[model samples]
Target: MSVRDLLVLGSASAVPTKARNHNGYLLRWDGHGLLFDPGEGTQRQMTYAGVSATDVTWICVTHFHGDHCLGVPGIVQRIARDGVEHPVDAVFPASGAAYWARLRHASAFRDTGVIRERPVSGERMPLDTGDAPFRLVARRLSHPVEAYGYRLEEPDGVTMLSGELAARGVRGPLVRRLQQDGRVTAPDGRTVTLEECGVTRPGQKVAFVMDTRLCDGVRELADGVDMLVIESTYLDEDAALAAEYGHLTAAQAARVAADAGVRHLVLTHFSERYRAEDEPRFAAEAAKAFDGEITLVHDLDRIAMPRRRTSGGGA
Candidate 1:
């Protein structure tokens, strides 16, 4: 059996509070895992989350921030220590090559497996790893350092109408041709249109944005996405600080989600000053502005995507 999910590894900002860890996440799909922003102590965090280095197929770092990529050396060392034979797909900002090189050789260790670097810089995204269910697109975000946001979209499928097929006398042999050619001529010399028997449904999309302020990239990435996981490093009261540091507050993220048509808004990357008691107020403040489902993330919280439904209440 295969499982697909986004595991919240750590959700704190630059500082790790007692309750919150640093910035880390693991997207698991089809028995493969992609770790994003493995912050400090990610190895132990993974162990606590029941994740292993062997399960990882990719490592994506949004930037070279100490809180985002500091754990890379440890994770790489673990792979080497365990002698993983499989290659690890690595993605980061191309401009951060120096940082990657330093982290790659932060300590003396053997190369565990193949390390393929998939760096991003501009609007366009590189090719997918060719294994995931969705196309991964990267867009530039408003961050002091070089940073980008990623969006994943699955392909749409055609919905067949059983009643239409039966009325048209389409059977096993004829149905295949109708599907392949989008048409079929019956013995009665009647033509059948594909649209008369089938309908097209839109695909699901997911976006991840972090360590950035409200910008066009946020709207573009979150547009029509089923789930939008973004950073909320501060509260609305400290909006000024958020701007100075290139971060978004809870309300700012909510407003963005409201405009982007995101189905679920997951606000994470919280500052260490706030505690669990403050999360409810923060969530409430965000909810006031955005009508979508809002979640103030906690480490190790397993969040499932809402079952497929019409877009924005059927638009």
Candidate 2:
């Protein structure tokens, strides 16, 4: 069966607590699985999550931070170990080419998986997964390191209405002909157009924002996305610390989600200072700014993709 879900493997920032692991996420979008920021011990996490190394079609590293990209070597090695025949695309910041090279070749065994390199920089950069119709977009974020956020966007298309088609007396091969030719002659000899039987369907969009403070890129990435998975590394009380570390507070992340009209806001990458008991506080702080569905992420949690927008592009 086809699947579209975001699986949280790890959700800690900088350091891993007894409960939280490092920072790893897997977004299974249709035919492709996109692994983002595979931090320390991600291979084990994937095993625990019932995910296979062969499932990964793309690996996206937000930055070269140890807490973000340490597991790349393990994951890459595992991919080679599995001997996946398909090519896997690896996306990273262009500035961290040396860091990426070092990590990719940190320790080589038998190189078998065909891992393709795709580096991103400044403003908006596009990455193609080759399997999906949608393209992934990378936007620079305000971080101490060269960090980038990613977005998956599907192109606009038309949604056929069966009722309209029936009413137009379009059936059998004629229906396919109408779709292919844009117009078809009905039994009544009247010309029926595809537009008359279909409505404009807006594509779905998902965004991932991590390890960044309040910045224009954050807003741009989160803008009108069905789901926004962002990092909330600190509580509102430690806003200064968040700023100094180039991270977002729960409230700040929520405000960005609210301003960007995000449908669902997933706050993760928590600090070790906040225990599991303090999770409510994080959700409450974000609730103050955003009225959308707020999810305080935890390890091994799976979030399904939001339902597609209705015809006429209603959210």
C-alpha TM-score for every candidate: 0.91, 0.96
List the lowest-lDDT window of 10 residues for candidate 2.
126-135
- Model 1 scores worst on lDDT over the 10 consecutive residues at 306-315
Candidate 2, 191-225: lDDT as tens digits: 99998998888888899999988999999999999
> How many residue pairs of model 1 clash at the backbone?
0
Q: In model 2, which regions exceed 4 Å deviation? A: none
Error of 2 at 89 (Å): 0.3
lDDT on C-alpha atoms for all candidate structures: 0.84, 0.92
Listing every candidate in turn, what is its Cα RMSD in Å to the true structure after a full C-alpha superposition? 2.3, 1.3
Taking all chains together, the TM-score of candidate 1 against the true structure is 0.91
> Which regions of candidate 1 deviate over 4 angstroms?
83-86, 173-193, 310-315
lDDT by residue (tens digit), candidate 1, 1-315? 767678898988998988888888888766667788999988888999998888887888888899999999998888888777778888899999999999989988777656787888777575576766767788888889988888877777566788998898877877778878999986567888777888776677788898897888889999988889999888889999999999999999999889888889998998887767888878988998899788888899877765665432352
Q: lDDT at 285 for candidate 1? A: 82
Which pairs of residues collide in model 2? none
